[model samples]
Target chain A: MMTSTDAGLPALIARMTGDEKHAAASESTLDVLWVLYDRVLDVTPDTVHDPRRDRFLLSKGHGPMAYYAVLAAKGFIAPEELDDWASVRSRLGQHPDRNRVPGVEISSGSLGHGLPLAVGTVYGLRAQGIGSKVFVLVGDAELDEGSNHEAIVLAARESMGQLTAVVIDNRSATRGWPGGIAQRFAIEGWATATVDGRDHEALYEAFTTPHPRRPLCVVAVVEPKSGQR
Target chain B: MDMRTTFLSTMEEALAVDPRLVLVLADISAGTGPVLAAQRRHPDRVLNVGIREQALIGVTGGLALTGMRPVAHTFPPFLVERPYEQIKLDLCHQGVGAVLVSSGASYDMAAAGRTHHSAADVALLDTVPGWTVHVPGHPEEARRLLLESLPGDGRVYLRLSSQANARAHLGAGFLTLRQGTRGVVLAVGPMLDRVLAATEGLDVTVLYAATIRPFDAAGLRAALGEVADVMLVEPYQAGTSAHHVGEALADVPHRLRSLGTQRDVEVRQYGEVTDHDFVHGLDVAGITAAARAFFR
Candidate 1:
């Protein structure tokens, strides 16, 4: 029900209240999601189930109001469903379910699942001789999950050129990375980029740039964590 | 050949036949494993995710979603317990199926201590619905089960232990090794030999089962004719099959007892798997006593 003509992140989120919403999780990945749906990703409402359409997986699924907002703005889902998210009758839960949601690729409430799922998807797509690309979004804090490191290393070794891992950094990783977040991925032979999360044009450029014969990892540096920012 | 070797060779066959076959490992190497060679042959399909178990399972989900049949392999606890949530959400909850092949069942790696022992692996898997569990007693059975998982989209948990039965069961389901009139003893996986040894003189029929999930309720009911006593001895956990047995015999009044590994108390004492088996009342002497008492 929500169309781009009258919908914004604020209006969509305002519909779902007192439903255990994750404001910070959605806010941190908001700009990244917007940039991907609006300009970077080739998937539209029509091509959601098409094999040639680009695939976007939300690994950072704690706060999905922002994701729902973007999907609604792009006409992937009805705007009216936003008001009853996480309800007993609603298809949406605290975590997004791929079976219930229209555009969700993988169900994620648990951290460290998205990157590996994306790598697997890329490998699967290639096996079927399909060339569509996969993009997965995760939180900086979520990197602490050792699973993401496994995916990072393996994807690079396989030269997963069609896969892209986007880390939305809010300075939340416990015992943070040494040189920088992108450096960790770079050590694993990934083509890396570091950009400001809020800058729309920078985010779009980083996503669109080509990296031959290697998986792409983009570190989107957002504002400081909650309470500090 | 051992179950490990059979599993690898069978997987190689699966890969040769189906282009969709993808093998995922977690830093586990079995004598220059076949998958490693396949990795060189097809660099994209054979993936070693290091020792990360969560991603090992999660990646299988992604591969399955992309219409690939994935086989994720690792130690039991590392494969099942650590990334259980990943299996639940990414694979099961998503209604996608992947073959999870695990090594070191219970104290299979007894020398490796508690970290390697997965006595509760099957029971933990039992908590989740819709998984076909195969505790293969022999390499032949493991080979058959692994080959069977390829063509379908059903989820399967293939448990291969270091301890194997003396003979390969070239077939599946409950094979009637001995006939008796007093009671029926169901032996699961490696427990078959020990059960046969325990009931050497008892007037009880023994049935061996490697595929324990599809329970064979019809076979059990048919085997239960004129017998009201049934004892289930699993190599993994005790009382895991008590409910299944009870459900099968609900209409007919009968006595059902389950005997296997004990999970109630922590057995900090570590030695040979035989010691753990003795502690869990799965030894020959222990199973003999439980069988006699149940039939009495």
Candidate 2:
């Protein structure tokens, strides 16, 4: 019952192994990345560097293979670049370097760092009166970084409508940190929507719609199956 | 020069010259009366991000990224500690030039207790890349440094004290207090007064380093010239400042010494004390005593 788009993902993941696969597996949240790249996002390989293009920042930057895979699939990068990943003098490393990689708006690997940068980018675009939207993907574990809470609170307070903070709450932080996923952002007055991450239709709807009153928080809850990785 | 007065004067001057120079404040603007008045005068430019420290810094970086020169004000410890990642990744890494006005340095917040004290900010922020750390000893220097940083590239941390007294004028590079220097004592921030007072009758040169991170090594060596002993006095940790001075004067036959508190006290008690008492508590006097012990 697998679709053609869904069938291509596992094969792409299969080609990557060892530490690369392990890293990519953590970004199983890429089901959303796939939806964004293939369907929702208004970006093209030719217009990757265009200022008018929508900006996407991978805040949870540890598992870069998923991003790399999506970029390669989108023709933004060559498939051959995957071989040189994490290699010496290679542009592809553990994290995405915007200078080395194309279509990356900001270089990020550190947790809780991207939201504020995204906020800044959105604010910049608003000042220039540019209609470009900014999308940032943050991991649930990054909620532990108080800066994220600070950013969410400010976004809501400022009513920054163009900023969309996508939280991949896979329940990973529960293994280590206190507090549940929703409670942290709810206190900030952000309009949050929790969705099954693997659902493509719901994600597409959540991403494209504009929230004029408040900052939108889409917490995609992904349940990892046993023996999946 | 008293930095508080200089900061207020320069801000007023900058506002007069260019109306675009926006002063953003957190919810704590009432504590900074003059700054709050400036905000009231230029209501369009002044923005309050409430008590959210991280958002305040991030918004400032965002505002600066869009060609607005934002002077974000906050308490020292929370300003650096709360949104440290934002300062590093969002501001520094992205090459945004925003002036961070930190009001509490060392024991400036002694009345507010240890939680408000920003003794470790200099040492912590100095390590971050593309950051210019400026601690003006007095107000005139504060004015010069603030005006200089306004139109410059990259991020700068302006550490201001609550004390409102003028001391000495700071020039470009290191200023040598005495000429015939057998030994040199380098001091940064408000502690220069103590170091200068300590070396009043002594045959030693006192080098007041206005800019700490991009330290003037050649100037420090040129000033120290054949001096046998080298000492660093700070209200924060000695590792960062002492190491920089040591590296700058490596060729010279000199030994480096540092004096500051290593850890915060465990108790949560708060009390009022003069700047001298606060410095003494951090062994600033003891460090000077040790320096004199070696030099004499």
Candidate 3:
């Protein structure tokens, strides 16, 4: 039953089943996570604790199957470990706990925490004069939490140049963002790009594009959550 | 200098020497001389996130994760309660630590009304694990506690108050200021001055505690000896530490009476701190009346 797209990443994701309450949430970020781990992030399993290594913070921590799959694919965790996810012995819980999981930056399940944490991560890195870029992945619906706005506005205003926020927009937020998700960040002065979420090359370009002296917001627009399997 | 001023100066000195120390503010004390100077001197380290408390805490967590020691400051309500989830998930759950220095403890900004009051801060933090709560009674104690917390990567909440004790009792454990045979009276932070004033002629042991968490059970037990009559005069919500007292005296037949800010009803009035103190039964006269009745 596997499609051509399901050969590599989706096959890995299929290993962790029976806890698909946020299947849409996880599916929406699969391409973005793969692109980041595989192509963009300058982090490896060996450099998880390296002070000079770039940090990838998963702010959208719900339905983290896609994230775990990506991490496993990139050799951060064993692919077999994904099978027992949410089980008693599994470090991969329903939500990611950074303490228990390697290569995971912040322990998050609560929405709106990741962006602020990511903003802080950049500031912290900047304070030490370590020029490590911090990337945070948040869901569009997650932005509804006012805490994210606090971070969104502050990050841009403070000119957190080293921070990049990838907001996965699947049109799931109850009161949908009025001018689209990218506009939200753009209005706050963050350098933004609205790329097709499933387009790998577009995502790569959006992420790699230079947006100096300000934080970057890459809105990967995916299929509406309701339209997904 | 007051505890608040001492906190700023101590933080400034720490920032000057320790590059790893980062101060994140939600525009609380962003304009103060020490803070402004520190920001000017070390722009990268001192961050004013512009009235965003949740972001302030989240930023602190981020800093700690990256091996920087972060000190986040604001009022209790804004700093603690407002961004509670951030404190829980971002810092504690993330397995990193930060020094959360909060001023305007309880009703310090009495004229600001209940919107600014945060009597439930310590009690709220009690719900989370691995937090070191320090309610310093004097400026010196606040300075010492802040200095002690900066170097270590641990969860610490240094609560500073406008109301202060005449003298600072510097110790991590409950220091027995006066020994008596009747019962043990434990006074936390600013409550010490009033507790002492209230128990001047009474034959009750007066113990001062700047550090409330890790509750200092052994010190409380040692102060009590065999007699189990204990009274806790705290500055935060009343009975906030009653559970801790119960746990400490689980095996002993101890009688406990707790005195602190009222829990059942909000004062609903903006007045002087003295008025709020009297209303909460935290003033000298209120403490004397409560102590005499309970001890008798």
Candidate that scores best on TM-score: 3
**Model 2, which residues run further than 4 Å from truth?**
A1-15, A18-27, A42-52, A173-196, A225-229, B5-9, B12-24, B30-45, B58-70, B92-97, B260-291
Could you tell me the TM-score of chain B in model 2? 0.88
Candidate 1 residue-wise lDDT, A102-154, digit = tens: 88888887888899899889888987788887999999989998788888988
Q: In DockQ, how does model 3 score against the reference complex?
A: 0.88
Candidate 2 local lDDT, residue B175: 77
Query: What is each predicted model's overall lDDT from 0 to 1?
Result: 0.85, 0.71, 0.89
Which 10 consecutive residues of model 3 chain A have the lowest summed lDDT? A1-10
B210-272 per-residue lDDT for model 1 (tens digits): 989978787777776467799999998788888888888889889888898877877677689
- What TM-score would candidate 3 get against the native? 0.96
**A1-229, model 3: which lDDT tens digit per residue?**
2222543777788889754444777888888888887778899999998999989988888989889988888889999998889999999999999889989888888888988888888888887788888899988888899989998888888888888999898888889988788887898899999999988889989999888889999999999888533
Evaluated on the second chain alone, the candidates' TM-scores are 0.96, 0.88, 0.98
Candidates arranged by lDDT, highest first: 3, 1, 2
Positional deviation of residue A18's Cα in model 3 after best superposition, in angstroms: 6.9
Of candidates 3 and 1, the better by lDDT: 3
Lowest lDDT sum, 10 consecutive residues, model 2 chain B, at: B275-284
Candidates arranged by TM-score, highest first: 3, 1, 2
Counting clashing residue pairs in each candidate, in order, gives: 1, 4, 0
Give a tens-digit lDDT track for model 2, residues A1-229.
3332563654554455444445423456677888888876788888876666777888888877778878878888877777667888578878887767878766788787788767766665664566777788998777778778767877777777878888887655645434556556656776677788878888888887777767778888887422433
lDDT of 3 by residue, B1-296 (tens): 99999999999999999989999888888899999999899999989898888889988988888899999999999999988888888888999899999999999999999999999999999999999999999999999999999998999999999999888788669999999988899999999989989999888899999999979989988888547899999999999889998998899998999999988996898899999998999999999999999887
Error of 3 at A51 (Å): 1.0
